[model samples]
Target: MRADVAFVNGAIWTGDPGRPWARSLCVTYGRVAALDDDRECAAAHETVDLGGRTVVPGFNDAHHHLALRGRRLATLDVGHAAAPTRDRLLGLVAHKARELAPDEWVRGGGFDQNRIGGFPTREELDAAGGGRPVLLSHVSEHIAVASTAALRAAGIADLRRPPDIPGGRIVLGADGAATGLLLENAKKWFDATLKPHRIDELVGFLDTASRTALAEGITSITDPGVGGLDGIGMGRADLHGYLTARERGSLGVRVTAMPYITTTHALAGLEPGVDGWGLDLGLRTGFGDEFLRLGAVKVLSDGSLIGRTSALHEPYCAHAPGEEPGRGMLAFDPERLAETLGLLHRSGWQLAVHAIGDRAVDLAVGHVEEAQRRHPRHDARHRIEHCGIASPEAVQRIARAGIVPVPQGRFLWELGDGFLDALGEQRSRSVYRMKSFLDAGVVLPGSSDTPVVDAHPMKGIHAMVNRRTAQGRLIGPQERLTVEQAVRAYTHGSAYAAGEEGIKGRIVPGLLADLAVLDADPFAVDPRDLADIAVVATVVGGRVVHGADALA
Candidate 1:
């Protein structure tokens, strides 16, 4: 009756209310078999001495972009650390241009105009590219700038007369010439430059992302978008890439991929009579097994808040020169959005609508409510991704509809200044509200939206508890969460959002044997030092996936 593997001499945060802590844990066949102080519990074929370290359930990032993060890791370095100034950013682009062939695109990402002083001008990029096309994505990934060469390469015959794009912007200068700043869906026009990755290339990206997640003690992730919709995902073959990665044993962490809603059209299997709004027959939400599964249909209902494109009720505090002031834009018209949500809901697919601004949130809330009224389904667990700015009334509606609000706490640390500038002081306080959602009796899942920021769960936990911006400014101090509450958000809260709470979130008996052993206890450390704590070892299903060398 001995366990298969045992961890001894450790402090385990079980995440279960009744039994909150344990001194030792035993795993049998990849499920937590027992948690006891008895030395007998340590009698297993293989027992690891934890050396009194602290253990918690492995983190589950509810809104990460796996393959995209890996791709960014391999791209040009222009983030705050890599290029902190305008000169550094342009210098990096220039250097990349020199290394590439004259015809190749000089690509870069993760540059923040807020920190790097300002967005690089199209003319400035033209010089850096030296006639080579260049495209540098803002850290938010919602906006990007392309060199003049790139516009021509993309077949734009007239810079001043670019095709009219709804739900996107092609910035025009005072002279009425294109400014090269592409916002929201406008980036899709340069698909030739941003080519879709091959299945093998996608698997490679997944491999890189998996290693990074394991190192961060993240055992499960819900990638918000895949299947190349609106130029956000990898490609149409993205699901195949994930499956190949899993079959090849390259993906070490569990993934619940939310395929783009429109991707269903491009996919095979459309019955002549049946609606084509969902996956093939018998494949809906919760389709696959533990390693890889379909979670929800990702619908990009609005743009990025930091990018100043999210639909808002009030005008933005700041504006670009020569630009008229206005509230942000929605990706879909209200009628179109309602129709889409209704179709998906009736088809038994959970909807993860990305609504950032209060204006967009209102539409999303109303859509979900109306969908349920028309065709009610219990425990549907529809999610509102990045419900960034929810008023008290909106929060109440969210709770009443049993919607999960997936907000990234790391945004406070990475994009807080941009948010402050965009929404001003009063409205900024309501952005990314954590405590208020909890107060309204709603589950708030923690996420990083990585590649936009750091993916470490500790960074998210620290940001949630501190609410401090990168400039040392604190916003919404009253909305700050306790350290324990923050930790739970990354653990049980995220698992609950993905409907995996019964299996993986807690370290209780019969739950998956997934744990993250840390060098220091998050509960015992200073709130400011949460991000500094290192993961000593990471275990997935009783097998050490990261830091095995240190444990050995």
Candidate 2:
């Protein structure tokens, strides 16, 4: 039998202990045809020798923000600097302002108000923007600071009360004036008025993002919130882009898209089931030819922790006496969330809710469990995104409900000290509790939540296993996992979250041909040097997508 492609002479980690190593693999029609000794294979249409380099199943980012990532590539990045002061931030904005055409909007992102001390006022933004419309997004993407010109462009001057929109806020000044900060839905009002990018431009950015992912050994990604109208418009176009790229032999990674559920009413026309039910245009969660597929129904339950707006059970540590409860905005009321969950659950759609604070996590978990009791979605594999501050009770409930906790392990490294300062040591100790979740028998799928955190799996693995901050401070040593456990969360555990464990994840026969070759065995490397381990090559669907020379 002739195989479409064959890889030989490599150290392969199948991610399955039973068949943890393989010398060769045959692929046909973009799926693994067989895995065994090269001598046993009859024939192959194409062959590539790895020269004894390491190989493993392609890394899957179980949760990420793809469109936001693309946008950030073109925006002013303030994330990499330290203690960004008012002057430093404006200096960067001013620099970007010079690069833009007059009257064209200047956009930037990844600014953390926590580190910056406070958000910039509209007047300050206007001065730095040089009379042009300027919009800078918070690192969390839940909030944005816009200049007066931008507000004028959006026709939102002297902002009065909006019609009680859920899950959003417009911060007001002492004089009862609207500040430049637009939280959640309010940010959408300004974003909607911004210039739209051509589909080709978006596709190009996506190409760049994909290449970057491959360089990091990422072979698959689950996009948490794809902006679209009933899975049409942007979502449909993105799906087409992936398919077109694959068909034209340009794509090298797999994508699982989750539709954002801002309005449950939109799902009315969409069908249910993995096949033709919720599926459309040859796309289904577990279907397709392994390039793109529909995954989960994503819902934003609360705001961002950095924005100091995530719904918490107690007031923020920084809150003064007699202050309003710092509990963040909820996108939907409990009744509304319950209604949406019931509809989706009854329709057999998988659900993933973004819940950050302990209170938000409790609410989201309650809704999922209640939906299960009312509608009984046994195999949907519901998940809670950003279970960042899970209490012991919440963790137990998550385990009891059999919900997957997709935690952003990198946050511990990225914001550990700040979190420790903000939430107090007691609460901070519970941040990204991988070992606790594992002990409770809950599946803990590690993720990067890119654009918010760096999307390096090694960074996540190191943080998960070490439970240390970037400065080497031990934040939650008791919550650390073993090296093997962390790796499994990135590989098989993520696959299970997306309901693709049977087809992807492991480097075994009958699975999609997605693998990553590394410079050294992660297990053998020093724990402190784990983040330095390099990706020698990355292969997806039988093709060498990156580092062909390294593989040899």
Give all candidates' CA lDDT scores: 0.87, 0.76
lDDT of 1 by residue, 184-247 (tens): 8787555534667888888888999999999999999999888864657888788899999998
Per-residue lDDT of model 2, residues 244-346, tens digit only: 5566555556888786674234333444533222333423345554567777778878877768778888866764567664657776787977777776676
Scored by lDDT, model 2 comes in at 0.76
Q: What is the lDDT of candidate 1?
A: 0.87
**Considering every candidate listed, which one attains the maximal lDDT?**
1
| Candidate 2 wrong stretches, greater than 4 Å | 41-45, 82-85, 159-164, 229-251, 263-289, 319-325
Residue pairs clashing, model 2 = 272-278, 311-328
Location of the lowest summed lDDT over 10 successive residues in candidate 1 = 265-274
By TM-score, who's the top model here?
1
